[model samples]
Target: MNVLSVALSVLETALVFVVMVSVLVAAHEYGHYIFARLFGMGAEEFCIGVGVRPLLTWGRRRYRLALSESERAALPMAEGALDAGEPPRELNEETRFTVRAWPIGGFVRIKGMVPQEDGSEVRVPGGFYSKAPWKRLVVLFGGPLFSVLAGVLILFFLYWAVGATRPAGTSIEGIVRGGPAQAAGLLPGDRLTAIDGQPVLEFYDVVSRVRDQAGRDLQVRYVRQGVERETRLQPKLAELPDAVMGSDHLPTGEMRRQAKIGAAFGLVHVALGPVGALAEAVSRPQQAVVGMIAIFERKVKVEDSVGGPIALATMTDAAVRQGILTLIEWAGILSISVGIFNLLPVLGVLDGGQMVTALIEMLRGGRRLSYKVQNAMAAVGFSMIVLIVIGVFFVDIKRLVMPSRPMPEFVPIEAPKR
Candidate 1:
């Protein structure tokens, strides 16, 4: 593609990525808003982006509706004066709904979440801090819970519309040129029936056997054009790219060595009924959560396994090229991943961190932690999150700018003439 075309494509992809992210964020924040409202913790403001000024607004304290700059400034100023103990101009009952210029993420502001150090308290009814710990816990859990539910719903719709994709058998779909499989004369239509005389039930069985015998010759038996054929090939040690590992961490600069035959194959899609679709949808998120836990436990390397926003956008672009079904499935996966990550009980400004603070207060028999200590914890958490985002961006840039080395080829041994 030309420079202009490439630029446009990148911009388009970025816009789509931003829209998808905004939807996910909105879903999460809406969960908190709904639950807060349900429990009488009134939301002061519900916004779908972050900025000093909103581009559009609804509900109470509305602005930018063909109003002049001075007029717009007067609204917030009046509210500020009222907040400063001045006489109320009018009692505003509606919660502000805003759409900011920056469409990155969103937030829902609950009333009286913070404690006043001067021994003063918010006299407003249904303040967040006025609720019991259990109520607060439910509110805190709502965001992640909604994210997970969104993922499941996406999957259900995808399965109902398209189908549930799963492994069918051990048929080879494609082979990497100059790789072991191609060199071994394994054609695309070939089906692996056995390996070293061991029956191959599925594609994974063949992969498992090959992974265990790197650099060693192995007998492969397959059906080609309805004829049983035998040949010998060795799995080569390849320095695979860290992106393949699908972790969230940055690349370690050290390549991961893995055994590979350089062939790609996967399951076929089967149309599902409503019940089957629901089951598949539920199971998929559970598997994603388990996989994420594996990544966190260091059982998997982040660079090789995890992907950040760039990777996700790239994947989404690829899915768009493939079809809408693939894109929907990817969206579901992304939602589930975000949901699980947000629920990690770490010392940060995340939902889990807030939940942890509430839990501590509960354990202390309703005694709250000092604001100073909470602020320190929040600061540390924010710093850690910032560092992680930087690392992910670095890895993403490196992957885009510097491609990995080409895969090494292997020469196959000729089969004896029949």
Candidate 2:
């Protein structure tokens, strides 16, 4: 890539990453903000980002009851009091606004977030601790629940925007020499009709069937030269390394040899119906848990497995180079992953924190705990998450810095001279 083009790519990648992270963080904060409002707890501030002042301000808005004439008349005095550099005679309780900041991570600073002594003179009714157990539960759970929801929406947009692969009739586009298909005389231009007796619609479906039926005979039906035929072929059992779609580390020759399974007959549909979306949302968490366990067990290495923003962009760029269908495949994998990770039960950070509080409530007989303790515990959990994010960032850096493997040299088949 030229310098300018490369720069553009980097900018695009950064933009996509920022959008993903900011949106996820905002969704999480919104959960807390919404629930706090619902339960009548006053949230003093809701801001995104950590350290810097916001580059721009979008003032918060709330529905206000119309003021009586006397109250309206008092507004000018209140304004005058502030303009005259004097404290307002009394704080007006009517108008409240949420302030948004430029930084992505945010907080819902609710009243009485910490505990107070029972006999303390400084008790506030709107304190977080004063809220009922159910209300607290909802408030705590909302952030992570919303994170998952945001992830689902992201996945949906990814699918809809990037588009899903339509499954067309399976046709052999290329062959690997000495491989089982090649050994069985499977050649380019042959349309695969069925696997055993089942009709085959897409090449990927065929791949799934073949992988499952390893070492077994494949009673494959194909059409060639305007004639339909059947051939019994066995897929060779060869160990393949774990890799994501459109990875560049794949053997160039191997990649070149593999058939392109593009332009399938049926559309890869994503139903926007509530049932489908909810099903996706519910299933994502389980998938994330399974994936996490697999990674922890070393069944999947972090390098070969996970992709943060950099990796995602690298993959996207590579996929775009490869073709459109591969991009869709990557989108599917990323979507499932985003869903799963948000559902983790790690306390204090987001969903996991909510789960933790719920579990604590269950143990404590439904009594509200000190909000201070809860917030403190959550802070610790959030710290842990920050550490993990740092680790992932390093991992991403390593991948970016590591040089890719050199493409292999291949000998060409000599055609017979006339």
Candidate 3:
């Protein structure tokens, strides 16, 4: 490929990675928002990104009627104020959505989720801690749950619209323009059954038959939409890239003359019924869990198996080159991974650790940790997250610099004097 093509490919890879990450993150945040709303632990703000200042801000800042008269006076009031011992003039809005100045990242601020929650929570009636411990557990679980569900839905769609690949005895995936296949009235989705009156079971059968019969008109029999048909085609002799020496290395700059219909043979999509699709889709989460276990058990080397954003871009680029179905499969797997990662129990900032706290509070008969302790955990958790990100980036860079499978060094050989 030329330099321009390489640049374009890299651009496309970055775009796909950004889009995939954005969608999954949105799903996760929306999950938390919805569950908080459901349990009356109303959120204070929902912003696409945390920024220095908001680009556009709307919605009223409703004053909590439960706050003391003096506290109400000190608070900045929007809309209007209420008289002493009088009710609020307008209904309170639980949350206000904002578009921030930053173009990337997102955050949802749940009410009374701060370190000073105890002191400030009096301003709001249904603070997060005010809810039952079980309710808190459910709220914490919501984000990961949504991410996994998104993966399941993607898998289901793929199964319903594009079934798994069938390599052997596959149908014609595409017809080459202005080539023999097009000239002979051959179209995509046609299943090759025979060539020149000889039974053709695999791709090799067609290759073997046509490779030696160039320039000779041969009977090509195929099944199209359940109807058997026949056509004749004269295979053209074309010089194509044919690589050999395939033991961990392939020789470059090699070409061979072979017969060609000028078409690509690939997997055929056989869509499944709704029931079957749904069944296959839901199984993905379990498979993902098993894989995670394998990684943790040291059966899979961390360096070989795990990577950060850079590695993600590289993998995404490779998947894009593979085919549409392969890319879709990668997406489904990635969505599931996002859900799984959030549920890691090691970090206080993650959903799993928060759920553990909720469970512990419930077991301790409603007693909760002090704000100071919670703040410490939050600080440590955030610091740990930052360190982890840095570590993963370093690993990705190292892997890129020193690839596990080194590229073969080729010694160019001048063409022998003919």
Candidate 4:
């Protein structure tokens, strides 16, 4: 692609990434808003994207049709008053809505999310921290739950559309030299009808049966050229050097274990389509969460797993080139990542911080911390998060500017003219 085209592609990829992140964020905030509404607490404002004022409204009515001369003139003065802690004749509708200059993410605002110290009280009813602990947990849990649900839905659709792999025909697509299947005289296109006298419908069934066998014998049924045959295949439990978890991969041990099946795709397994899809969807989020936890625990190094905007855009671009189904899988994985990360209960910058605080409260017996304290902590957390984001942005930019080295050149000899 040309420079402009490449830039556009990158921009589009970034936008998709932002949207995925923002949607998950919106779901999390919506959780808080819904619960706030349910608890009879006031929810002052909700919005989908960040930066710049798109339109202004109060309740369900559009208050400011456009940024008029009158409205513009009133903006500075109104903002000044609001900043000064002077309440407007009524809560300014404009204050309740905003469109920021940057549209990277979205947020929700509750009137009294922070607790006040010095016995000072919140006059506004809908602050987040003011709600019951259970309510707080619901709000806190919402983001991850939304993300998981989103994954499930995506998986369901993907599965329903594509179906899952099963072991009906035992055919070795390619066997490693000296590997178990190869040693058993198994050849490509061999139909595996059974394992250990048990009829197997899916490739996964054979894999599952074989995995626990470490050193046990596998009785396989095969049909080759219209001939039925059985063979005793001893599965050699080889200590393969990390065949999975690539340098850029950060899957947990659990994830690795679940995906370690080697079975041939066949017709009988394909018949159980819905079941396969459902299983795929449900397992996705769990995989993501475990991956994240593994990364966090230093079991997986950040350098081995981390990717900034550039890396992600590059991956997305690659996916786009590969085809739609591949792209959907990548999108699903990224969505799950965004969802899982945002639920990390650290109370400040991301939605998870408040959740962590709420969880802490749940574990410890005490009146909730003052809103002021919570807010201050949140602010600190938010500031730190902003710094990290800035750092990532620079890292991404650095990769763009610092061109990669050209591959080493090798000279080739010219053959004699014939």
Off by over 4 Å in 2: 52-56, 62-104, 114-123, 151-163, 176-179, 196-208, 217-219, 228-232, 236-299, 312-340, 367-383, 403-418
Better of 1 and 3 by TM-score: 1
TM-score of 1: 0.76
Model 1, span 118-178: residue lDDT tens: 4233343456776677778889889999998999999988888777766667887777777
lDDT values, one for every candidate: 0.73, 0.58, 0.70, 0.59
Q: On a 0 to 100 scale, what is the lDDT of residue 16 in model 3? A: 79
Tens digit of lDDT per residue, candidate 4, span 1-418?
A: 7999978877877776666555655665666566655554555567666656745343442232223232233333466576775333333332254434454556666556645665332333334554566677777566566666776777678768876543344554544455566566665566777888888655555655665576666688876656877777777553321223322222223533222223223344242368657766766776766667666666554544556767786787787778777777776677677778777655666667767676777777536766677778878888877776787776667667875434322222222122
User: Largest lDDT belongs to which candidate?
Assistant: 1
lDDT of 3 by residue, 148-234 (tens): 998889889998887654344647766666678778877767788999889988776777788768889999998877888898898
> lDDT tens string, model 2, 353-407?
6666766875787665566776677788888788778887888998778854433
- List ranges where model 3 is wrong by over 4 Å: 49-91, 98-105, 117-119, 166-270, 405-418
Q: Which stretches of candidate 4 lie over 4 Å from their true place?
A: 1-8, 44-97, 101-103, 114-123, 161-168, 177-179, 182-185, 193-201, 215-280, 290-308, 325-333, 347-350, 360-366, 370-418
CA shift of 56, model 4, Å: 9.7
- Per-prediction tally of clashes: 10, 14, 0, 24
| Model 2 TM-score relative to the real fold | 0.64
Which scores greater on TM-score, model 1 or model 2? 1
Q: Of the candidates shown, which would achieve the greatest TM-score relative to the real structure?
A: 1
Q: Candidate 2 local accuracy as lDDT?
A: 0.58
